[model samples]
Target: MSTIAAISTPAGVGGIAVIRLSGSEAKTIAERFVRPLSDHKATYTPFVADGDTVDETMVTYYQAPHSYTGDDTVEIACHGSLYIQQAILQHLIAAGARLAEAGEFTRRAFLNGRLNLSQAEAVADLINSTTEASNQLALSQLRGGYQQKLKEMRQELLDLTALLELELDFSQEDVEFADRNRLLSLSENIENEAMRLVESFRTGNAVKNGIRVAIVGKPNVGKSSLLNALLDDDRAIVSNIPGTTRDTIEDTVTIDGLLIRFIDTAGIRHTDNPIEQAGIDRSMKAAKEADVVVYVVDATDKENLNNPNVPKIQGTTILAINKCDLIDHINTSTPNHIYISAKTGTGLDELKHAIVAPFKEVGDGAMLSNLRHFEAMKCLLAAIRQVRQGLEQGTPSDLVAIDLRDAIHHIGTITGEVTTDEILGTIFSRFCVGK
Candidate 1:
């Protein structure tokens, strides 16, 4: 295959940028730009490239069958000036290296059978991770944790399939090389694991993205003030009048190493104004869908808390009593209530801790972060259900085998053992160029 070249580092100026070349001609093409640093002219050497030298760059070479793509690979570290990076890349292209498409290097790794689809996807996840939890999940996947689990499941299915196929060969002899009870138990175990993986997708996906925490209450209760305090930025407009915020404003804040999406929703209240009513409706919707609901109540107004018009709180609801500094007579015994003065930043730390605690419990470990993996797990679960029903009825081993194999195929889809080009394109195309 021809060599492919790209600027592997992020665009714009930085301390340094990396230009990568991989494939059969990688070493040959790299030699055109970079001269060997060693006196002995070793195949692998630290060197500086020719042309407009941005810096005394380091060049490392990896030989075929031992590199990232299972082929020759070269990496050049150059000064991060855009002009120099572009000049080096253009030089490699002129020296007979084709420009790599988005995720082409990773695609080459997949094509060369170096890594499976799940591991390849994890590469992107690791790069985009914004939280410690997300980084750990991605790193685990990249190290083949998910792939190993899928392989074990597939091996069990393969064993059952082989036994079933052998049984068909001796139909007249009435031979049973495989134990029926053992096969049933294996199917049950696979089904249970598949279901667990399917269920984990929800928590995993929420962790990868930030957990949505919506601040909802009646207007002029300092919802905007609360948002600004949490973010440590005055992003929303604060006002004394009701319905000052006519739309939802979202900001992300990292709390306890987890990213929490703080949404300042328009206050929920009955209104004759159409725009205000629409905002109220949106607030109610966001409240219902949020991972945690911060029910903001004005500490100065005891009447607001008793108001029957307040929307029903759901999920993990935390009652945030705003303007605590101004209220002398405030209830301290309320369950899950946090007293905070958003204007004064009182008890803000406690509020942040409360917001992060729920997510930590939801996804502790073994979370499946990819949606495609989740969908495949769901499909595998359905197939396992069929196998369970077949076992309960004492159905023929042949029919049970079919369901087992179907479940296996669904599981295989997660790791690209059984997948189509359309799915591959959709998965890899989302990656940034030069990855």
Candidate 2:
């Protein structure tokens, strides 16, 4: 492969910037501008190109089969000047190093067997992770936690498939190489594992890309106040007038390491006005899609708490009685209500806890965050169930082998054991340039 080079660091001026190169001609291209590069050692050197001194930089070299891309690689660390960085990149390109496509380094790593597809994707996740939970989850996947689990399950299935195939070969000999009882038990366990991973996608997606919390309540019930109080900023306009929040006001804040995206929607109330009705329509949709629904009710008005619209909202509803400071004594018919004064920042901590508590079920185990992985696991589980059904019903060994192989193939797609050009392009296209 031809040499590829790109700026690996984020854009803008910083203390330093990194420009990386990989492929067969990586070292040769680096030699054009960077000198005295020792293998596996950082060598501070002057960068010269086109008979002009550019900048003083540090160069590190890695030899083939041991580097990030399993090829000869070079990384140049230079002062974070836009002029200097661009100049070095142009020099490398002028010397025959092509600009790298997005995620090419990690793609090369995957192609060279250094990392599987799941782990390769985790490289992007680790880079884009915004929270501790997301960081740990991505790191776990990068370390092959998920990959190892899938591989173990695939191997067991593969062994059983081999037995099934052997029995197919000795049909006239009446051989029973694959045990029916053992296959049933094994398939059941594999299906259970796959389903567990599928179920984890909810928490995984919420953690990786902030939990969606929709604030729904009647007009003037502190939906916008709760949003501002939670974010500690005047993100949304607060007014005693009904329909103040004509549209869904959205903002995100990290509470206890979990990202909570607060969507303060217009209060739920019947209105003849088209605009307010549109906002209310959007409010209901947001509530339906949200992971947590914060139903703000006015503590001063008991009738508003019993608003028929409140019961229409779905999902994990946190009944927050706003303006509790005004009420001398709080009385609630429901046991699952949290009394809070959004105007005074009272009971906000408990509300935040209630929002993040649902996501606390995510343990140390690797989760299925990617939709592609989840779909593949769903297919895998379905195929495993079919195989289990065939074995239990005493279906022909050859037919059962087909389903078994299908299950293995779906599992392979998750790890890139079975992949195509389209899959690679789609997965890597989402990565930032020069990954």
Candidate 3:
């Protein structure tokens, strides 16, 4: 592989910036800037390019077979001046190192066996993680917890396949080398495990991507005020005028280590105005797709509250009777409703608890956050089910062996034992430059 270089740190000024290089020429290109230092140690020295001093820098080197990319690697820590960062990167590029693409460094690590595909993805997730739960999820994957689980599942399938295939060698003898009852039992076990992982996608997705909650209601029902109250900041525009929010406004807030994205959408009411109607259409769509829906109703408006026009929702819905301060007596007709004043911040705590109530019982086990993994597990479950059904029907060992191999292949794609260039390209492209 050719040598690659990129700015590993964020752009703009900071205390320090890092420019990284990997491949056979990594150390050599780095040596051109700072004097060569002992491997695995940092040396502070002046960086020079084109016979002119660029900046005083600290350089660290790691030799092949032991570094992140499993190749010779160099990290140049320079002062966080935009000019200095650009100058150093240009110097390396001129010195035979090409610019690194998005996730190219991690891709090389995956190719060189330094990390499995899932773990490589975790590296990107760790960088992009917003909440503490997301951080923990990424860290667990980085530490090989996810990889190990998939590995165990694959190994079990492989073992079963091996035994089943061996029986084919003695077909002429009509000798049963493996017990049929045991094979069926093993197939059932693998299927159950795969399905369990498949079931975790819902909770895992919420943890990784945050719980999506849409604040939906009719015109001027305090939907924007409720959003501001939940976020504890004026993130949305509030006004007495109906249809103030003509588009969906979104922001994230962490509640009990879980990120909750509250989307304040346009008031849901019949309107001839194309813009407001479009916004209302989007509001319904947002509520439909959200993990939780907080339907805000004006408690002071007795006519609307008594006959609430609640849309048919798909997920868990929490009734939030807003503007309680205006009401003389908070007498809610609905039994499972929380009355709150978005302006005065009254009963906000009860509203928050109601939002996360459904997902609170989801345990902290290995879960599937990535859609690719979930789909693979679903495919794996289908294949294993085929194996189980074949075993029950007393089908020939060779036919059962085919489905077993298919199951193994599905599991392999998750950890990248089986992969295509298109899938790899698509997965890595989502990462930012120099990951």
Candidate 4:
């Protein structure tokens, strides 16, 4: 492969900037300006281009087969001046190094067998992670936690395929190479796991994006107040006037490491006005789609509590009684009820706990966050189901082998054991330039 080079660090002026080079001629091209380098050693040298010293920088070299791309690599740490960074990059490129495409370094790493496809995508997630939960999720995936699971399932399919093929080879001899019932049990376990990985996309998506929680109820019931209180910002206008909020107002905040987006939607009430009716329609949709719906109600008035339009929520529903400070006593008859005064911040912490509780129920395991990986796992799960059905029905061995091989292929796609250039280009193109 031809040599590629790019600025690896973030754009703009910082304390320092990194420019990286990889491929067969990386080291040789870097040596044009710097002194002779020792492998894996950082040497401070003057960067010379056009017979003029551009800047003094630190150069580190990594020899082939042990580097990030399994190729000769060079890194230059220079002062973060835009002019100097560009000067050094141009010099390197002028010496036969091509500018790298976005995520080319990591793509080369994947292509060279240093990292798998899922892990390569995780590198992007790790870069863009905004919260601790997201960071940990990306780190866990980068460490090959998900890859290991796929590897084990692939091994199971390989074993099953081998057994079936052997039975096919001896069909004329009337030989039973393995117990069908035992294979079924093992395959069932794999099926359960594939189901698990597919289902994890919910938690993974919630973490990658913020968990959705809609503050919904009749108008003027402190829905906006609750939204502001949750975000600790005056994100929504709080008013005593009914229908003051004509549309949904959304904001995100982190509570105990989990990111929750609280949407203050227009009150759920019938209105003859087309504008207010449109808002109500959107409010209903938000409540239905959110992972958790905060059913805000007034503590002083019980009349607006009964509503026929509250969407049927499939997820957690918290009946939050606002204006609790005004009421002398609290009532907690509902299953997931919380008494809170968004006025004085009373019970806000408890509300936060209740909000993050449902997200924690996804359990501790590698989750499917990337959409590509999710699609691949869905295929894998379907293939596993097909193989299980074939084995249970005593389908011909060769037919079972076809399903088994398909299962194997899906797993391979997840880990880059079987892939094409188009998929690789799409996956790596999402990354920032230089990584």
Q: Go through the candidates in order and give each one's C-alpha lDDT.
A: 0.81, 0.87, 0.86, 0.85
Model 2 per-residue lDDT tens digits across residues 119-208: 888888889999987888788888876777778888888888898899888888987887778888989988888988988888789988
lDDT of 1 by residue, 1-435 (tens): 888999999889989888889988888887766674332133433333554454556777777677787778888887788987888888889889999999888888888898788888898899899998788778888887656766887887788778877897888888987776777787788888777777777668878888899999888999999999899998999988888999999999888778889999998777899999999888989988887889899887777655424456555788888999997887654566888999899989999888777567543337788988888888988998998889889888788778877888888898688879977897789788787
Weakest 10 consecutive residues, lDDT, candidate 2? 306-315
Per-prediction TM-score, please? 0.88, 0.94, 0.87, 0.95
Model 1 ranges with Cα > 4 A deviation: 36-56, 168-175, 300-315, 329-334, 361-365
lDDT (10s digit) by residue, model 4, range 1-435: 999999999988988999999999998899999988999999999988878999999999999988998899999999999998899999999999999999999988988999888888889899999988888888888888678867876886687678878999998998877678767876788789889888888778888788999999888889998888888888888788999888999888888787888889998777899999999999988988898888888887755444323457877788888898997866544455688999999989898998898666433346777788889889988988988999989888788788888888988998778899978978888899988
Give the per-residue lDDT digits (tens) of candidate 3, residues 17-54. Answer: 99999999998888877897778999998998878899
- Which pairs clash (backbone N, Cα, C closer than 3 Å) in model 2? none
The residue pairs in collision within model 4 are none
Error of 2 at 84 (Å): 1.6
How many clashes does the backbone of model 3 have? 0
Residue 108 lDDT in candidate 1: 85
Flag regions of model 4 displaced more than 4 Å.
Answer: 169-173, 303-310, 360-365
RMSD from true fold, candidate 1: 3.3
Give the candidate number with the greatest lDDT: 2
